[model samples]
Target: MIRLATVIDTFEADFLAQYRDQLTPDHYRALAAMKHCRTQASPMMQVKCTACEHQKLVPHSCGHRHCPHCQHHESQQWLERQLKKQVPAEYFLLTFTLPAEFRTLAWAHQNVVYDLLMSCSWETVRTFSQNDKPLQGTPGATAVLHTNTRRLDYHPHVHLVMPAAVVDGKQKQWRTKPRGKAKGGYLFNHKALAKVFRAKILAAIETAGLTLPARYPQEWVVDCKSVGSGESALIYLGRYLYRGVIQENDIVACANGQVSFRYRNAKTTRRERRTVSGAQFLWLVLQHVLPKGFRRARNFGFLHPNCKHVIALLHVLLKCVPGQTLAWVKQRAPILCTCCGAVMAIVRTRIPSPFTGQLPISIAAEGNP
Candidate 1:
């Protein structure tokens, strides 16, 4: 199978040439990470399984979260840490969206808009949760930011895993509510949130006095969802961040120095076509993928910022403890014992993903044409 990294690396130059006119610092950083993944290495060990005698040198993975291949181990480690943070209270899946009018602006200023989206969403949740009618305590939540729609369009949004209830300060009570029970919770009362988000963004724009187009809308587009809790939501969120916001399946092809991709209508799921020059295609891909150090998925509230402490306190108070967590995450077959179906016990160590084969150029061909 052709790794996505291979495709990205081979076409990176083509992408840069196309996006040269629109390149930014973030784009450069993302390209650099993809192109130079090997430099940042993790500790890998080699050993033969005592039970199965499966001999192999296990290659270490680069721990960079942006690389899909590298995230499996890290994701498992994170989930382990989060187990301690699971509370008995219900959880709410909250989403915040921006209107179509801000599309152009968000594209031009990704760093700014992305930052604003997270900050504003947190503000809205905090405000509502702390209101006298709501949970009232400092309701903790984890917010993950996604920059694309199902079809991989640059439609930035934030997904928040909010506790169905929260505890504020030293108060001795825990508030629990069903997801979607809050008035305008799923809708998030976009009319009011739009005003708050718009005001926050407008203030920034005014402070910066950004150049605006002639036709800008007064209203903002926002959406919220309160998906119920289950294994489905966690699994869904995990895979949601897996592939590129824009998947290769949607990419038509690169020909005639141009590239075409498909997108689906949000409301209708109808396929829509978009074509760009080869360079433009490269630009779009590079622009949409996150920079190396920038994390698209973030944990907040009780799930982050010392999840151990907050969760420990919550557990002690709530008289709860999560089930046993997993040991080291399960790696793929290449590293596992074929006979025993278990991680090959570590014996020795090596640098980089273990070099399983010789370089293609190093192998001499029998004859030359």
Candidate 2:
């Protein structure tokens, strides 16, 4: 189970020792947390089996959103929740990308820029959905902020999971039918999407006192592709919610103060490996660590948590059983005994002594000593 954390745990102290002055508190904190994550530095709990009387110690995860190791459970929970909100209609994956001129500043002003990106994307979807020519109903969308390009470059963009169908504003009834009997199921005008999206993004930039080059293209990149059935796509996109720009599985090698990892070539559609210094690799991952308490995924229109009643009404409109959604998201307990087939219960729990970085000798001596 060698992972990115293994490299981090081994090399991060040296990286920090050399580059501490150049890093931020968040970067230092993230690296420290990841280094100690699920290791001796973290707290542990003692769970005992009722039948076999066997005891086990489980370490606590740092549970930081950017920690790739800890966020798998969060991703699953999000996927199931989004699936339950699915309607019997078409779905669209809309990506609103910043212009080339904006990437550098967008990284520097991440919170402001990303918030504006999400807002503009939501507004674009809302406005287009409300156009009388299309339908007067509002569509629900969830926006995911992505800060890395395929090459792991610092390119900030937003990925939106939006439905092709819109619902009546007041009635909350479906305003769209199955897109087409065949393959031509177009949702919105891509040209117009590009136009509106660019306009909103530029306006937001100016409003926030941010500047873009005057010679920049009038149209920013807006990708709108209809995912055949959104259930799988929505679930697939859920991976980005809690993960870093890349995953542990993507790492190919880590040695000699360098790290190599694979990425799918966006243009050639082929796999490629990239190698960089350990410090640079740490920088690549840390830059995407969001501001504390900043949300990476957001629900807009009816999918919002504030409008749960609206979601309930929509569920009724779509004929979804209340009980079924729970079945879709049943969380499994973690403490299972292996020696005898029985459930384990937490007999005692406490943080290990910070000074010694170890649990009490009485408990530590029992299991693996």
Candidate 3:
């Protein structure tokens, strides 16, 4: 596998020279962290073997959310939390996409535009659920914002995993969409969903004091399809939730002045490869680096963190077992000692690099009298 750090180290100078004017502080931060992640240049921690009196210093991971080598545990934790909140009802995955004309505007004001995209999408679904004859109440959803397509293009959209059920707080009841023989299942009319979503987002953009693109399409695209049980969809979204846009395994070749990577085509459902210059490839990945402190995945309504009690009550009311449907998350492997085959426990951290003008504690003690 071609590591992203190797590519970054190889093309750093050229990439910086070409794109320095356009790079943001977040992009620079991500680059610096990824370039040295788990490498000797990063800080180190001293770990001692539990069984034997042996110690060694290991390089620390960058812990950046965009670094592919880190945050596997966090991604799994998020998935488990979502799984625990699952209820016994049909689920749907709705995609609300910002049109191509709005890409430039979204890039310029990503914080505002992305926030509106997710919030407005939930609001649209909430409205439809409240107005529906069967489910006349508030609905919950787990919304994830995806800024890249399968080919790593700058396409901003929000994918919402919503159960076709609503909680009527006023009536103190739970209601689910009627099941029929319509193949996978059915929810709201997707065409009507598109219309309402378009109006809400367009109005929201103007309300946020941003100008709409003059040549934007009159019709926006919103896709809603049934995902039975919703476990597989959640797993799919969790795959890239904490990791960066592209995984290292997908990076097939990095030779000469160009890099190549593969992606599964959404239309054909087949693997396809794209090759671009090294600098351009770095830009393709870094361009999706979200702003600092910006959240990519969010829970809303009954699924919100504050509403845990609601989820608990619904679990009992719906007679749904939390862990029955989804498979258990495997525990992370512990770092073991090479000498005794025992788990190593960290004793110290933030050991300075050799280039930092300060020597590590052990090295400094050795030099002293």
Candidate 4:
């Protein structure tokens, strides 16, 4: 089977061959890291119930959240973590996107564009939540940056998870609010927020001395929707981050000196086959190389400042209040061992580095005969 890592490897080389001399030191390192290694691994089991036997092995997965090959375990773990932080009230997933006309500019000014997206979105959400009459205080939120569409194009966007209830600093109360179809729940005003988001981004870019298409200064695209609940929100946004850019079904062929993949037009369902010369393919792969210490996921607002402890404190405080319940509990699902039908105990858990022959070491629970 043709692996996504191989394709990415080819692309990394192509990138260096073409732009090695042009990239800065940091960019060079990022490109090299992307080109060489980016896979993570977890233990998996194949169980044969009838035979009362099981096979345990360390499965290597493309650790790239953007790669489809490694999403299941990664996303599941992330969801489990999010579930523990769930509040009793409604949750909303808000997405902020940039216009396609800026794709080339984004590619050219990755650092500038990416920084603006994060800052602008964060400020926009924070300001809007506080200004909304229903949510009079700063509505706590967590936002993440997403730069690629389903087809791996340069579709930069931001995803935010916001609470329906905002803490009322003045009265020390929890103020609940909703907008549009999400009445009585955590909702965002898309049209209004979009307008403000556009304004904020343009202003920020201009203040930073960056120029945009002259005719499109007033036109920036932003999309917002209220995806409900923390679980649903995780599942929805997780899909975009994990298994996002590359698809297993989209693999056309891998042979000779080239590997081909398919992508669909964002505006149309029609499929298109795009083949990169082996060198060119490697260059594309290098584009995804993230700088070391660059976190793909982060928690902000109420969830920030060491999320678990902060949320635990909030949960306790909420229980003491009039409307909140103390029965809220966080539960984790059990992982069963396929081998011998025994409950598998995790002896160790490791996230492997992308370099080859690297594996995560974990031991299973065993019972005495």
TM-score, one value per model: 0.71, 0.87, 0.94, 0.67
User: Compared with the true structure, what per-residue lDDT tens digits does model 4 show for residues 1-369?
Assistant: 566556655454555566655554444433322333333323232323344344343443335454556556666666555655666567777788888777677767777778788778878888887887887776666667777665555577888887777766578676666445534443665778889999898888888888886556455555665555565666666554555456556777766767787877857878888876666654454455444455556666556645566567667876623122212222334445555556544443343434344211110112110
Q: CA lDDT of each candidate?
A: 0.60, 0.76, 0.90, 0.60
Off by over 4 Å in 3: 325-328, 355-369
What residue runs in model 4 are displaced by over 4 Å at the alpha carbon? Answer: 8-77, 178-186, 239-244, 247-252, 256-258, 262-280, 306-310, 317-369
Q: What does candidate 2's lDDT look like per residue over 1-369, in tens digits?
A: 357678886567666666656565566567766766777678787889988899988877777788877877788788777876776667889988888888777767878999999999999989988884656778888888888886777788888887777768677467764576557477777789889888988888898998776668876678887886576567657776786778888888888989898888978999999998887787788877888778888998878777788777877767865345444454645678989879999877765835334332222334421
Candidate achieving the largest lDDT: 3
lDDT of 1 by residue, 1-369 (tens): 334345554566676555556765545544544444443233356678767787865545544444445555455555554444667765567667766777788777666677777877877777767773657766777777887675445777887776667776577677765446564344245577667766676676656556555576787755555544422345456654644445545666665666667777878879888876655555556557665455677776556666567678878888875644333234444456877877666777754453332211111231211
Cα lDDT over the full model 3 = 0.90
TM-score of 2: 0.87
Model 2 weakest 10-residue run by lDDT: 360-369
